[model samples]
Target: MKTYLPQIERRILVRPNQTFGILNYDMDNAYPQRMLELVAQSPTAKDCWNKRAKFIAGNGFEEQTLGKQVINSKGLTMAKLLKAIATDKALFSGFGIHVNYNANFKISSVNYVKFEDIRMGDTDSPETAGKFALYSDWGRKTWKNIMRNKITFLDSYNPDEQIIKEQVITAGGWKNYKGQLYYFNPEVDDYPLIEADSVWEDFETEAGIKIFNNREVTTGFLPSTMLFMQSRREEADNSTDIGSGINTPSQLEKDLGTFQGAKSAQKIIVIEYEDESAKPEFQPYAIQNNDKLFESTERSVEARIIKGFSVPKELINAEKASGLSNGSEKKEAIREFNDNTSPDRMELAEVLEELFSHYCSNINPTNNWKIIPVPANVADDVIGVKAGAAINQLLQSSVPTESKIATLMYAYGFKQAEAEAMCTP
Candidate 1:
């Protein structure tokens, strides 16, 4: 069989600003790229993007922390580890895992490999089985590439440990090994190796442009006002023998220097002239008004960016959401969190289920075992309304108090004895 290699150059050529799958010039890149090169990057955009990514990632593990029940398999204990890997990939766009096994065929441990040191190869050729190379540095020096059906244990920190490390090469198939290493590239179609790109990159650029424009406005027009001076007489004359008069150039230079000095010191300027008929008037030029427009533009752009991430505006305390009450805002936030955030968590859970199915089967042979994300809680208002409606219906119906007490005991986790005692009263 012919060994197939992917078109590595094509993948490498994709820029950070371009869309994931398409091979065309990114119009979004033109402005943000220029802003990055010209202005100080907007830390606000960067911070918001980071916070949003982390928020999304954390929402995946709702009500559960590390050491909690994420995955319930005998040999494969990878619930917390999988969550961490998924979070890292969401933040950095890629993540890798190194699967370790003991002398027996069962899996032993699963460790997260740094994304910076792992390079994916031959991605276009799925038939040949893509390669994963782990290196100590970004330069690709002193690296080990794990080819198809082979596992290479890398110890870059200690030279002595490196000498003792064993490289397990399995030729039969991936199924022969107790565990295998895997690299997850979430944005591989959009961005390749040697480039940084994320969902927030465009937002960051838009923010950068706003910041730059504001800076320009402040520096150019905010500090000082333009001064306009008009004089009734153009020429000054003195009674000299041969048209010898006051040097207008020297006098004008002196006046300009005095004006500048007065302006800098914030002092009142008083001009005196020898000619009584030479009348002069001073007027301050009006500053241009674009502050409101700039503010509106910024808000619009920010709104679009927040929408792009499918995040609720209330979560970010957006100003445009002033009409919503605190209670309504809280309800909206919870609804968005449950409806939007849970799907991503479900997709991640599904991926982990497929990857760790082998060990999952060992744990529960009779039934299919899979990883499941804990569901997000519903809004308190909705829950309260439902409970109220149910209580109203029960009161209207002819259900016995004893039956209601028993139902309450079962539904609310109340002790049956206590419920019965309350009913007796």
Candidate 2:
């Protein structure tokens, strides 16, 4: 732990669910052990890599049969990808140096806890820092090593609150609240965070830089670094144990099993394309230059956006600033208003009818490109919106700039011709 993490800085996301998870090396600072050879391979990766292995593997997972995918750069399991490069020199040297993707932010960061903390959800009791007990055919060897030697399996519990307060996540049996930390309990979902008592130790932070403000120099982790640190806690319970030896650990990218990773979140869906048309590179027949697209880390990407046609000069941070560490009681924290308003999960029939009727009225059939309320790209906030609520809101907002206007409308809730008309100028 003494060696400074080259291009690595931890990611901390503060979302409505108050979620936080790891966002491994940003592409610019990204270097892969095995895929360094493939660097010249994929230009679409003019973006980044999986940094930590959770690269997915499945039959035709990234298959060409899926259609309209960009250059089919073969994919791999995050674990296999990592295992191959962990020993490669090119991987070490290029620790964090790749071309920038969004270029929205000046600096980027990576996390180390994925290497330091392994977690387990206490089925018996999901309260306090519940420790792991041996419960598998993997033998006692793996258990013994992990307990004392292997990096501690942290629960990956709430860190934002701790980050905000700069206080110990757990003090005795207590979890922290507004001015205090509280303890764990069975009935409470909001309180009693399951935290390991001892804070991670020997974890060192050193300043190293590949480039800074157009020049390379030592610096600190900055930017709105918030990621969904789901930490495979969900995937662990669903995983099928296959490995017998401790060293020959199960690869993070098992052929078809769910693992602890970002895509595991049901809310975060992926719509991966095996062909170029489905890819971000080649514009589809329906797309125009003004349209915008966002990529999800999941195997298949989900469309949850509508970017403004003309770039809005002002960017706003409408995110709730109630603070992540606010230890509110379970009863009080339940969202009273937003009980169930999902935009992502709406029915298309209703949407089509609405749009179809609109077409019969206001649309100009002569031109499809000149229209109001055209689909815009998805924004981060809408991603958190419930499936149905997000969809309806987007159509009504009709913000324009989405790559797929008809499909999102039909799938969620919009009229076909009117929805098309919505896209026409």
Model number with the top lDDT: 1
- The TM-score, computed over Cα atoms with residue i paired to residue i, of candidate 2 is 0.15
Clashes of each: 2, 77
Off by over 4 Å in 2: 1-109, 112-117, 123-159, 162-425
lDDT for model 1 comes to 0.45
What's model 1's lDDT at 173?
A: 35
Q: Which ten residues in a row have the lowest lDDT in candidate 2?
A: 201-210
lDDT by residue for model 2 (372-416), tens? 111123232333345446545655774664644855555544456
Screening candidate 1 with a backbone cut-off below 3 angstroms (N, C-alpha, C), the clashing residue pairs are 20-189, 20-190
Single out the weakest 10-residue window by summed lDDT for candidate 1. 16-25
For each candidate in the order shown, give its overall lDDT on alpha carbons: 0.45, 0.24
Task: Estimate TM-scores for all models.
Answer: 0.45, 0.15
